[model samples]
Target: MGKLYVVGIGPGSIENMTIRAMGAIKNSQIIIGYTKYIDIIKSLIENKKVFSTGMRGELDRCRQALQLSRNNVVSIVSTGDSGIYGMAGLILELKKDEQVEVIPGITASSAAGSVVGAPLMHDNCNISLSDLMTPYELIKKRVELAASGDFVISFYNPKSHGRPYYLKECMGIVKKYRGGSTPVAVVKNALREGQEFQIFTMDSFEEDKVDMMSIVIVGNSNSYLKEGRFITPRGYKLMD
Candidate 1:
């Protein structure tokens, strides 16, 4: 039996990918991932047999990857940390008898944070606004609590054509706790060639401006904007 490796490719940037992730892909005879994610690493997967699927095909993709792993070394890839919102858990649940390993990569939250500024330097939490698998009620509750606690928030899968209203609802919950002037950053295609970073305030934030590829970083009560960078300071006394 061959081994299965679940790898995270990071924010769709080769430079952001971990060495172990690349090694896994290079060693595998087959590579599987979401259609767009596979396209992101197309150069690295040159000669390998790649299988891709569109949205909502997670289960099918996992099964296919495992089936191939039974006879050939396989690497299932995900953009950002696989364990974060990737295929690692689904693969493990159906592994049956295959030897499996999970390789971590730079998650979009951190990647987007790095590109915009230091918004995550203080206490933070990552929340996905996509309600495909998770219920919106639970997501709303979590967002409410996170905002009430004044934690810097990283929002993933913030919006899509089908679920456009979810982000608006989430932002409403956030605005209830955080002041309208709270700092926020919208990072689109983080770490990729066509990256776009926009800094705005909670009141001025527009839900229509974001999409599935965007990662939204909202600052805590103590966060601020300075010199075009959104900064969330870690509470620490400085030595004079």
Candidate 2:
């Protein structure tokens, strides 16, 4: 039987993609992904049979990929690490006995961390503020627990036109545990074209600056800013 490869393209940049991800795409006769992710690797997928769908079509995309993989080498692409909020889980869930290979790549949290500094050097957790698949109440609970535990937090799908206030609400829960001066980094389009980021404190964060393409990192109580870098120290003792 043929094989199905679920590949993470990595922040929509060729350089950021792992060799195995590229190889998986090159080895496949067909490629599948969300429309924007497909456009990101258009150069590498030239002349291949391509399938794409817009947002909210994830199930359809995975179904199509599975069907195609029965007869040909097919690759389904996700923008970041396949296992983290990517298509890998859905693909695996839908397949019964298909040969599947998952290729990992740089996730947005780490990519965003690199541009800002080592904000994820210590204990951290990623929570998606999007309420499509998850309930807002549960998300709020996760944020509260992560914040209370002093875990550096990275939020994905932080804000959107329809869900403009979700991030603000979550930040409110965070404030109960973290101080107003905690560092926050909003990294947009990390490692991609038109990339930009800004650092702000919990009290001064501009909600308008965040969107779906951005990753918002809120520092723990111990996290701080130094020399324009957002850093979360790993509790290492320093020798004087």
Candidate 3:
């Protein structure tokens, strides 16, 4: 049996990707991933066999990768860290006895956090607003718990045409625990071309500015905005 490597490509930028992730892809005989992620690493996968599928074909891609790995070294790529809402879990669940290696890379939360400032300096949790796989009620409860616990919350798949209202509803739950002035950062295409971010208060956040490509970070109660940066204090006293 051959090796199966699950790689995280890190925010669609080669510069953001970890060296191990690049090495895994370079050493693999076959590459499998979503279409968008494949395009991001097109330059690196030249002369290699690549299998890409569009949105919602995750099962097929993982199965194909597993089958191919039985004969050749296969690398399945995820946009961000493979374990974070990525293919690593699915691959591990399906593997019978294959040698699998998960190569971690920078996740969207980290990428967005770096772009906006230090919003994730303290305790934080990543919550996906997309309810296609997870129940909507559970998603809301997670949001509420995170907010009440004063953990910085990073929302993935915040909005799409089909689930436009989910983000607003979750934000409402968060508002009940967090103050209206809590800092929030909406970062789009983090670390990639056309990257942009906007910082706003919880009450002033514009849902229209977010979509599937964006990662929204809502700061904890202690978080604040300084100049243009969003920050969450880590409780280290500083001299004035």
Q: What's the lDDT of the predicted structure labeled candidate 3?
A: 0.93
Clashing pairs in 1: none
Give the alpha carbon lDDT tens digit for every residue of 53-132 in model 1.
99889999999988888899999999899999889988988888888999999999999999988999998999998887
**What tens digits encode model 3's per-residue C-alpha lDDT throughout 89-136?**
999999997889999999999999999899999999999988889999
Q: Residue 20's C-alpha lDDT in candidate 2? A: 94
Descending-lDDT candidate ranking:
2, 3, 1
**Deviation of model 3 at 62, angstroms:** 1.0
* Residue 43 displacement (Å), model 3: 0.5
Give the worst 10-residue stretch by lDDT in candidate 1. 204-213
Per-candidate clashes, comma-separated: 0, 0, 0
- Give me candidate 3's TM-score against the actual structure: 0.98
- What is candidate 2's lDDT per residue for 1-240, written digit by digit as tens? 889999999988999999999999999999999899999999999999999999899999999999999989999999989999999999999998889999999999999999999999999999999889999999999999999999999999999888889999999899899888899999999999989999999999998999898999999998999999998999899899
Clash-forming residue pairs, model 3 = none
**Winner by lDDT:** 2
**Candidate 3 least-lDDT 10 residues:** 172-181
Can you list the residue pairs that collide in candidate 2? none
